[model samples]
Target: MARILSIVFNPSVDISCDAESVQHTMKVRTHNLKQYPGGGGTNVARVVAELGGHAELLYLSGGAVGSMFEKLLAAGSLAGHRFPIADETRISLAVREEQTRREYRFVPEGPVVTTAELQPALDFIADYGADYIVASGSLPRNAPADTYARIAAIASRTGARYILDTSRQALKSAVEKGGIFLLKPNVGELESIEGTKLDEEGATRAALAIVRRGAAEHVVVTFGREGALLAGSGGVLRVPARHVETVSAVGAGDSFVGAMTWSLAEGHSIEEAFRFGVAAGAAAAMTPGSELCRRADVFALYEAGSRTIN
Candidate 1:
């Protein structure tokens, strides 16, 4: 089994519920309230576990909510390492509109972190020996923008392949620093990093540009419903999307990253893993609320695309 370490700098307790319609200044009644230990890295770890893979999650925890978060992780039986902090972990909300099937997500900028707290987290990651180190999600407020870049440096030093999925300057700083094994960026994020708009062709070129510049070994650019582009030294492989009845869009990106990493760790080719990723992303959309891709749904979609995936 591949030893995977997922680091969550800005963790959350995800709360999701459904309402008939969303209106301003009106008391809305929601049904089926669901809560989960959430954050980019935690979601990735959960997806890996759902896919029958083992991943150890490392996240910052504090306050009452942080204790609840720990219990939630325990409920799922996921292997989690909690690092202490003074601030409370934030909460993210996802509201599903039943009439239109739209999801409204409200994410808070996470708590501030002191340099003292930040350094220990970095040291823990640097010393840990894992086959793959995945750093996802946003950096907390007051945390340095180059935090992911520092983690990338640790990944290089430890000889672990690093997979980065974030946005804005955090993404740009890491890419500019180089040494990423794989970079997963959405269309808007790619545009932000390159400082320009990109069509499908433009996005492909930009992804290839990152690889050409030696910023990363592989670049996976997701184009929402259109599909995704996987570019690297070998070439670009376009993985088409599977049209499905989307219940909610939450967690789709994390599902894609987690499934792809799991597939690669299982010894599948990048092309094959990319196919699995697309399948997992589509599967995630088929479910409601913040719940990620179900294992059966992922397998079904993967097998459905097997004929054309290769």
Candidate 2:
């Protein structure tokens, strides 16, 4: 099996629960508490592991909360490469309302990372001979916006496929620098990157425009409810979104990238991988707060999609 190295600059401990109703000046009793190791790369690695793939996590860890994060990762038996720092990792919370089924999420900006602390992860990637290198999530505070671009250069030198999922300047800088094998950007992100408005009809053209510019070999433009469009040298392929009762939207994007990358690494066609990604994302959305897609749900959704396409 191919090994995947997932990098997360700022990882966290995800805490989730359910409350009867949320009111401004009242104490809302909660139940069904669950905690998971989180952050983009951590979530991606977890999904890969759930799908029976070998994934190695590379993330920054420190502080008491960071120690708890390490314990959570160990509980899942995930192989991790920890980068030491002085600041404690952040914690994110999600509270689901039983009455309205609405989820409220509180996310904190993670620790500020200095160049010295950030350099080791880049150095690790330069030497790591993994089949795929996935850098997911937001850049830590004070980290260079060109962080992903630097990672792209290393991937180019080492001959590993680079998969990027991020937004804003971090994403823009990377795409501008080029050498990304696969880029998963949502519709709004594509609009931001291309600096234009994109409707469904214009989505494929916009994605292809990114490919033609040599920014990325393949671009997947994901529409929250409208599914995704995959554009590459082979042209554009559309994968419709699977209709499922919404539970939580958190981690769906990461699940999509993780499943798609794992499927592609397992020798599936790009189209097939896209379908798997769609299914995995739907599966993630079907779960309650903070929890990712279950393996059984992912396979079940994938099989259902196969039937629909066939």
Candidate 3:
């Protein structure tokens, strides 16, 4: 098994429920309330474990909410290492309006992490090197913008493939600093980095440019329903989106990153892994609320999609 470590600077307890309708100045009754451990890296780790792969999860935890977060996480299969912090962890909520079938999500910015609280994670990465190091999600307030870039450097020093999925300055800093093994960026994020609007052809060109410039060994740009495009040394490969009933969009991106990393670690080729990733992402969409892709759904989708891609 390939050793994988997933780092999350901001973690949360995700609560989701269904309400008949959301109206102002009214107490709306909710049903089927569900809670799960959530965050970019945490979700990725959960998805990896769901696919029968093991990934070590490292996350910041503190305060009363953090204690509850720990309990929720302990219910899952992932082996998590909680780094203590001073501030309370955040709680995110999603309420689905039954009338419109739309989801309303309320997300907090998360706790402000100090330098001392952040250093332990870097130190841990240096000591517990793995085959792949995945850092996903947003940088909490007070953390440096180049945090992921610093992680990429540490991964380089330890000879581990670094996979980053983020947005804004963190994304720009890492891309500019280079040394990333794989970068998963949505179309908007790629556009922000390149500082321009991109059509399909332009997106492909931009991805290829990043590869050629040594910014990232591989770049995958996700285009929601249209699908995703991969650019690397071999060239660009495109996979169309799988048609599925989207119950919730949560965790779809994390599923892609987790499944792709697992497939690559399992000795599959980059092309094969990319296909698996698309399948996992679609599978996650098929699920309800914050629940990720199911193992059966992933394999079935992958096998079905593989035929068309082949």
Top lDDT: which candidate number? Answer: 3
Query: Model 3, which residues run further than 4 Å from truth?
Result: none
Stretches > 4 Å off in candidate 2? none
A best-first ranking of the candidates according to their TM-score comes to: 3, 1, 2
lDDT of each: 0.91, 0.91, 0.92
Q: Return the lDDT, model 2, position 241.
A: 86
- Candidate 1 weakest ten by summed lDDT: 242-251
RMSD of each: 1.0, 1.2, 0.9
RMSD of 3: 0.9
RMSD value for candidate 2: 1.2
Ten residues in a row with the worst lDDT in model 2?
301-310
lDDT of 3: 0.92
Clashing pairs in 3: none
Q: What is the TM-score of each candidate against the true structure?
A: 0.98, 0.97, 0.98
Candidate 2 achieves a global lDDT of 0.91
